[model samples]
Target: MLHRLVEPAHKQQHQFILDRLVGVWLTLGEFMGDGDYGDVIADRRVGVRVEISEGQDRYVCPACEKPMILASHRIQNRTKERFYFKHLFDDGSCSGVAGLGEKAIAALRFGQTKESVEHQRFKFRLLESLELDPSFTNTMAERRWVDEDGVKWRQPDVQAHCNGQRIAFEAQLSTTFLHVIVERMVFYRRNGGRLLWLFRDLDVSHFRLAEEDIFYSNNRNAFRVTEKTVELSRAGKHFVLECVWHVPTLTRGGVSDKLAHGIVRFDQLTFDVSRGGVPRTYFYDYEGARLQAEHRLAERAQTERDQELRQAFENFYLPFLNGELNSDQVETEWPELLSRFRSRGLGLPAWPDNPKGPFHYLLAAYSARAGVPIGTDHEDLVKLAHYLVDKRKHTLWIFRLMLEAYDQKEVMRRYDTTGRWLSKVKQYRDAFRRGDSHYMPNRGFDDLLCFLFPEISDKLVQAPGTFLGSART
Candidate 1:
């Protein structure tokens, strides 16, 4: 199941890891300095080095080369944690047979704990802590506590009796599935035991660590109180796990309020509230981080697009600014347009408010109304009437120029790109909706959209460049 989800890049990385593990395994055996004489050291020789036992180092399957975990098992009546290489996959072709079964491997990978050195250390530290506690002197590591049918319930990293309560302290470092955690919790609680899950610090990308609630605020919130956990440990208090509030910033390629990790007591966990009465499930909190990254990427792309548009706008209008352009030839071919916008009153807002001003706005609005790219057709009438209802702006005398434009679509583009010219004028909206072909009835409509008189000049601002594409940039 884990292998199925591995992306191409991750698969390559996993292959590299597998190769390294295999290399280490191939070099660990020392049988008369000859590779063929590989032999397994008996459990009686605790510190001996052999093909199977490589001192205190990690091991991998001799056949598949998948990394293995060193765990405890009773051997010759002595139980101790030892270097035991296990296969990661259930490949029958592999001659090695000492690793965990396929189901166990699947559970371990789901919990994101495959070949985790940090997880191993945390387990050892928890055991040591419990051993030092007077109330938990009966604490033991890797104890096979069984169920009524002699079936194995759970082999916690460290199990102890604290204050007359059986506790299972788990240093959860991997992305364990929710069902697994819930199952273990229910199993422990039913058999007179309580489960406490602990997490490492905010190392978000450790085996895709950030995708879990170990650092999230909602649902499966886990506090990251590394210092507090240590302080409490020193004071011999009941261990408290940490929780964090992972706040995502969705702005111009940056985030705000990023410090969202903290500590929480065991009782504060939601699972404890209903542990015995019913089962509770939790989810991963990594979506916040994923969304933030996506937003930042989108903002960056938009910025790049704006820059491109600005460059194109400059190139197109540079000839006019340098007096190298002449619309006389164009005017002759499209006489109606030249006559309609010939007057300054009929034009869009001028610079320095807008660089290309009326001319650019006219082209962009026409292009948008036609659903065509800019400069595609110079003679098509701007569509205005079709979009008047959506643009929700009052009719303008400039709209009368629809004799040379599409009345419906052009009207919508003008209203959208033009500033809130008729936002406060209720009668203008009513008049336009009724399809009145008369003069704009409201005074604000004429003042805001048609005239540049001093009384309403203060309200006028540069409209958006929605239709102009890069020209507005």
Candidate 2:
């Protein structure tokens, strides 16, 4: 639903028409004066027409006070569209309209600090309409309020108290910064008042799913809009507002349920508590959209972290994998590698010479992190666990560190057979005592090696049981 206001629009052509008309010398009567432009006002107000014609009498440019005349021309669209504008004399006299382009046209249309007469007209109308509601027992326009302590103060455009709740209605016709809006809202709320933002036109260009617009109601925990109010104003030929509920990230089902309380507007010329205050945002499916957004943020953060770790794995962890490092080489490099991984937001798999030695644990961690499975099946893990728990005749220590490569939740959810394997392993661990297995002192070495280094299981079968004993102990 996010969109940018694409430029080089037909509206720009309208501005060109307007600017050219302004450039021609005009009689005092022809000029609409400050706060009004016929080109702009006529387009918005139905039944009102703008008639720009060629002026015969000598005229003075408003910009340079040089001789000018209304110039008529046709613009090329799909068809030739007639447009008339004021043309200044080109006797190398007037500096006005000398170097005009799209920028100048845009400035003529939009770059104005003073409030247009139309904007003022709409604001006053809305204020008068608000006063008509009896529920707003206390209402004032441009009211300045100071708290009893005199520490907090505010001057709202239109302030009212309805049913003991203080509210300020702001009708915005131009763009405002997010921080300023938030600041005003916070200041009002802190003094026990709520600020309602009413936009003459919603800036769809700035709308984003993740960001909250001015219409977003923090108190009600929803984005609220008075659709009826907007429609009512439109009927009076005041202002037009196009409201859009952005829902690109939301799911399909139960979207209506989350929006039940989001739209507050007058129903049948009467204000009701149920429908006329502030409407909940129908755009976001409350929990679903929030969860999705949070998931995306989390995924992005994890991706950033993973990239760092992957870089470290490539630079540091890869060299240790070829089984070429000596004990001293490993001892010297292992700490730095662990530190680097941790610094880069990657969790170390195990302590050095932990349940298994550093090499086995590193291999498992690398395989898991790299998404490269070492080919150990679920049954092999069960067999390894069973052999360790049930077959050992004597034991210095017991270890249960195989299957460290896989996530517990993933194992539980993705493989139904893993549940049975877990139960079998648990059964043996719970029933067996220390010296009650067949393969004493060196039990489960082959199975452990097979489970840990499945890619080289045949070679690992010939590996020393001392390594397995060292791991178990």
Output the number of the TM-score-best candidate: 2
Scored by Cα lDDT, where does model 1 land? Answer: 0.42
Give per-model CA RMSD: 16.9, 14.3
Model 1 misses residue 316 by how many Å? 49
lDDT of each: 0.42, 0.42
What TM-score quantifies how close candidate 1 is to the native fold? 0.35
Displacement of the residue 265 alpha carbon in candidate 2, Å: 6.2
Instruction: Report the lDDT tens digits of candidate 1 across residue range 305-391.
Output: 545543444443443333454667323433443233343234323331243244433333334334442433222223333233234
Point out the worst 10-residue segment of candidate 1 by lDDT.
Answer: 4-13
Residue ranges of candidate 1 with Cα displaced over 4 Å: 1-63, 66-104, 107-117, 131-137, 148-150, 175-179, 204-218, 223-228, 236-240, 246-259, 263-473
**How do all models score by TM-score?**
0.35, 0.38
Task: For residue 185, give model 1's deviation from the true position in Å.
Answer: 2.9
Alpha-carbon runs more than 4 Å astray in model 2 = 1-135, 140-157, 174-197, 206-227, 230-299, 303-339, 344-386, 390-473
